[model samples]
Target: MAVDLPGGVFRMGSDTHYPEERPSHRVRVGAFSIDETAVTNTDFAAFVADTGHVTVAEQPLDPAQFPDAPPENLVPGSMVFTPTRGPVDLRHLSQWWRWKPGACWRHPRGPRSSIEGLEDHPVVHVAHADALAYAAWAGAALPTEAEWEYASRGGLDGATYTWGDEPRPGGRIMANTWDGPDFPWRSTGESGFLRTAPVGSFPPNGYGLHDMAGNVWEWTDDWWTSRHPDDATSACCAPDDPRGGDLEASYDPAQPQFRVGRKVIKGGSHLCADSYCLRYRPAARRPQPVDTGMSHVGFRCVRRPATVEGTP
Candidate 1:
């Protein structure tokens, strides 16, 4: 099911948070319908069964892309989160993330793991291309960054979270976020999930959409940008239906040689913890390589209103 969102002006970005989300601005979006939840495993399975499509994580890496790399490291794999025995350096993300071979959507934990009981859970390990392919097959499109943020706001502009300012209001966990201490990876069980919970596991937002905050990071159509445009000083200068940065600007600065572009990803994953990552907010955003898929990343689709032949 999808939810129809009545679009209007809403403040985007945050000046008090991450540097990338600075200089809060206002944006106006048009009406559109978005999936009630993240695309579930069952939904993706149906698309694959009908279209015979294969995800990028299932295909072997091209040797030409890494001519200097070792042969053993050139296997099909995706980034999987592995908890540490105890607390480690929080600055180094490699302490918990592992490149596990054969860890596709079908085999979430590796070649041996299966999705037997996870049919309702949001599908993970989907690269940006795979998400676009699924959206095309479903006769839908990936929501733009602006559209996604607007919908995530759920009619509460400038709210800290999808539900409200408080992340866990009244000692109640509203989303599937990492709740406990960061060392041993313990969950508070407030959302009854450790990694990715079933879609709609929590209550819906003002727009009747569920899992808009935490579950899995969702892919968006916009490219990655270091910062957003400054807020307009007057109504006449306000932007409408803004896109994102260009392809050249979206590349990873650490790897200048690699020309692969990155797209914007919205919504924090269940791994988001208050001790470290506090991105489970409406204005939060991240950058993801178009060809890379991880265990904590997934996506949803959106549909715009139809237009007549001569209608403007």
Candidate 2:
């Protein structure tokens, strides 16, 4: 199911949080409808069955993309999060993230893992191309970053979280974020989920949309930018449906050798923890390489109103 939002002006970013969300700005968006939850395994399976689509994680890595890697390591695989036995240096993400061969949406954990009992869970291990393919099959489109943040707010203007100003109102757990402070090691499973939770496991926001805060990081249509543009100086100058920076500008300057473009992925995942990536809020975002899909990343689709009879 989908919820239709009468989009309008809303404060888009955060001024008090992460640097990337600096210079909170005003943005206007047109009316659109969005999926109530991230695309579930069942939904993705249907799309694959109908279109015979193959996710990028299931395809061999392009030789041009990984020239420095050994030929034996070029096999199909996806990044999987494996908790460490104990705490380690948080600076190095490699400690917890491993490239597991045969870890596609079908086998989320690895070759032996299966999605048999996870049909209702948000489908992970979907690269940008895979998400786009699913969106196309459903006759929908991935939401722009601005549109996504707007809907995620759920009419709660300037709220830190999707629900309200507080992360957990009335001392109750709101979303399926990391269960404990010892991230990359242990999860208390207090949120009743060590990883991704079933959709709608928590209460919906004011728009009646569920799973907007946490569960899995969701893909957006915008290219990755280090920070948002400055707030408009005048009401008339405010951007309407901003799509973020160009693809050329989205390349990771730190890794010049690998010219892979990145896209903006919003909404924190189950891996988000207060002691670590405290980003289960509306404005938080991160850059993800177009060709990579981790076990904690999934996507939802949006249907924009046609500008004309045949136009997007």
Candidate 3:
């Protein structure tokens, strides 16, 4: 399902979180359409069977990318889930995210797993390349930071959420997120998902889009560059629609160069909670290597319609 965002002007970014999101700005975007839900296993499976597509994680890792790392690690694989037994230590996400060989979208848990009864669930363990390929197969494209934030707002400009500023209205859980004691245990089922719940299980935003804020982070076409641009302050819109920096540079000057050009992932996932990595809001963003995938990350597609002479 697709929602046509007759895209126009909207304020972008927030001061409440990362420095990259500071100094909210105004942006003008041509009208475009976007998927109402993240792409599901069923959608991608067809693409896979038809094209014989193989994901980057399914291919051998380039040793030069991790020269000092173990040569044994240079095998086909992606992030594997390791349930936390106790309080999380933010310093080490690797404790729960292991690079398991044979782990891909079809086998989310690892070589031993399969999508099985979860065909309707949003496809996880997909890297940016995998997602782009699927988008191409569907004849749709990914959204820009501006376009994504605009659609995510559900036409409620600067409202703090897709539904409203309040995280919960009238004590009802509007989206899937951690509700129990932080990380390690007790998922109170506030959003009714211990991991990723089926897409559209919760109420849709005002624009009728599902899973805009949580469930899994959706991949954007934009690479992580110069944070999100200061759209308002700049007098003119960037010619490049998806204004990202170099695929070889980081927004943060201090970060390593090899991590540059990583694609930005939006809409924090269920694993994110107050205990650590609290990136569950629309404005929250993170970068994943173009070839990295995880159980908590997925993607949605956006259709960029060509400008017509008479539509307003």
Candidate 4:
């Protein structure tokens, strides 16, 4: 199910925090339709059964891509998040992320983990290619960065969240996120889930869209680029199924070392924390390698919604 977005220009980033969100600028998008929620496991299952689709993580690495890595190291794989029983150093995120063989959307959390009861959960462990495949099968397409942000803004102008500027008004947790001590303390499910929740489990945005800001990092069709106002410019052209400009040698002002070559991924997930993640806001984004997929990554779809003439 998709909703027609009578697209118009909107401020796409924030300047309060996160350099990538700085110099928030105006972007005009043509009218388009977007999926009401992130792609669900049930949706993916149908695609697989119909096309006998095999995700990149389900197939051994093509020797062409892993030329430097040892042939023995090449294997069908995905990234896995190793939960810490107690507080551990948060400085290095790599300590928690590991490459696991045979890990994909079907085997999210790795070989032992299963989606048995999560048929409705947003499909994770999905890389760029996996999302593309499903979108093609659905006769839908991935939302460009602009479309995703525009939709996520939910008709709210310059608002930090899809709902509004205040993430938790009256101290009520809205989206799915790590509420407890994060690495050390257990998730209290204060937001209703410790990990990935079923799509639409939380409150929908003004657009009646669910899981737009949390649950998992949703992928966008746009490429990497700068958040610096000086470097940012109006999308020169508005083309159907538009993709953002190429990445520049820009630094996410907040963390310059984390440079901006990686493509932007939106919708922070359960792993997000005020003490660590600080990425629950709509403008907040992270660069992701197009080839990598993990337990926290998922995606939604978009199109010029079907409606009366001049109705997007």
**Clash totals, every prediction:** 0, 0, 1, 4
lDDT ranking of the models: 2, 1, 4, 3
lDDT of 1 by residue, 20-138 (tens): 88779989999999999999999999999999999999988999999998999898889999988777888898988999999999999999999999999999999999999999999
Model 4, span 7-70: residue lDDT tens: 9867777878888777777667888889998888988999999999988789887777556889
Ranking by TM-score: 2, 1, 3, 4
lDDT of 3 by residue, 62-138 (tens): 88877887878788888876777776676777767777899988998889989888788899988888998999999
Off by over 4 Å in 4: 67-72, 228-243, 247-261, 305-312
Specify the poorest-scoring 10-residue window by lDDT in model 3. Answer: 233-242
RMSD of each: 1.2, 1.4, 2.9, 4.5
RMSD, candidate 2, Å: 1.4
Query: lDDT for every model?
Result: 0.91, 0.94, 0.79, 0.80
For candidate 2, which ten residues in a row score worst on lDDT? 303-312
Off by over 4 Å in 1: 188-190
The better candidate by TM-score, 1 or 4, is 1
Model 4 RMSD in Å is: 4.5
User: Which candidate achieves the best lDDT against the true structure?
Assistant: 2
